[model samples]
Target: MTRAEIFKEMEEMFGLVPSMFKSIPDATLELEWSLFKQVQLAPGEIPAKYRELMGVAISAITKCRYCAFFHTEMAKLNGATPAEIEEAVHYAKSSAGWSAYVNGMQIDFEQFKREITQVCQHVRLARESMGPGDMSE
Candidate 1:
């Protein structure tokens, strides 16, 4: 789509053409906007609320205050609670910390992957053996 066409659609959908779209390079604006709409605004298997929450976590880890705030607001619009946003940020911190430790220590990648596989297999087996709502060993 041409930049003009994209801007028309954006205006129709958002009631105004956002400055962000106008600021992008003209050559790739259509592609970028298409991708953003498909991934961020469209219905998908991941669902928008969860995706927004994930965006918040990723934004937090990547130190993008703009994305963090945008995604947090979108998450709320998509039904995420304050508790969920807090937990997402907390999980992102924990994950980033663990990744930093492992990468810094130069842990074996193959062993880590194998351990993760084993853990998943064990958890699947345990879940299969247990009845619904049964978490006790």
Candidate 2:
């Protein structure tokens, strides 16, 4: 679509054309809008609530206050609880902390990958061995 056509569509869909869309260069507007629609605005395999939560987590990590605010509201609108939103932020922080530590320590990538795979396999096997009502002992 031409830039004008995309802007018109965006205005119709959103009731107003956001500055973010306007800021995209005309040459790349079509591709950028296509990706934004497909990934951010559209529902896919992942539900909207989860995707919004992820957006919140990433925005928090990136320290993008605008995105964090926008996505937090979007997540709530999509049925995420306040507790769930907070938990997602905590999860992001924990992951970032561990990532910093591991990378700082210069852990061997091959060894880390092998250990992670082994741990996953162990968990899968243990879960498979359990009956439907069985709790791990």
Candidate 3:
């Protein structure tokens, strides 16, 4: 993907283009790429750990090695211990087959989302205090 192509897509998504986008082409797989872009930017409705757990579960179920690795990293970033992450995957394996898992999952999701939202708000507040960015909006 040419740098121009990536910047163009980033510009469209967040008003300002991120230079990192230039490392990949957005048009080559627009459909999947767009979905990925949305997922990356969409607000989380659960704790980052929970989201990472879900990602791991989904990846395991879907047998996506790349996603498994990615979510593992995310889980670690969210301060999840390796044992906890492994437990999350085990829980997913045990219950993901049931249709009622959504409700159970939603419980965790809501909590995670709330926590993340609070953190974001706090960060915005801190950023406001420092006047490093226009976080008031």
Candidate 4:
């Protein structure tokens, strides 16, 4: 699609095209907007609320103030509670902190993968052993 066509679509979809879309190069505007619509704006396997919360978390981790603000508001509009938003940020922070430690210490990737696989297998087996109506244990 041409930049003009994409701009028209954006205006129709959003009621007003954002300046950020205008800043994208004409050569790449169509492709960039396609990706943005598919991943960010469109509803898919993930619900909109979680997707927006994920955006907020990612923006916070990346330290993008503009994206953080935008996504937080979007998440709230999509029915995310303040507590859920706070938890998402905390979860992002915890993941980043652990990543820093693991990468900084040069932890063994193969060992980590093996241990995670074993834990997953154990959990699967335990779940399978539980009878359909026996969730007590």
TM-score of every candidate: 0.89, 0.86, 0.48, 0.81
| Best-to-worst TM-score order | 1, 2, 4, 3
- The residue ranges of model 3 lying beyond 4 angstroms of the native Cα positions read 1-34, 96-137
Model 2 deviation from the true structure expressed as Cα RMSD, one decimal place: 2.3
Ranking by lDDT: 1, 2, 4, 3
- lDDT (10s digit) by residue, model 2, range 1-137: 99889999998998989898888998899999999899888989999999999999999899999999989999999999999999999999999999999999999999999999998899888888998657554
- Which candidate number would show the highest lDDT if scored against the true structure? 1
Question: Model 2 — TM-score against the truth?
Answer: 0.86
State each model's CA lDDT, in order.
0.94, 0.93, 0.72, 0.92
Report clash pairs, candidate 2: none
Model 1: worst 10 consecutive residues (lDDT sum): 128-137
lDDT of 3 by residue, 18-66 (tens): 4444444555545545666667535567877778878888888788998
Angstrom error of the Cα, residue 34, model 2: value is: 1.7
Q: How accurate is candidate 1 locally (lDDT)?
A: 0.94
lDDT for position 16 in model 4: 88
**Residue-level error in angstroms, candidate 4, position 53:** 1.6
TM-score of predicted structure 3: 0.48
True lDDT of residue 114, candidate 4: 100
- Looking at model 3, which ten-residue stretch has the lowest summed lDDT? 18-27
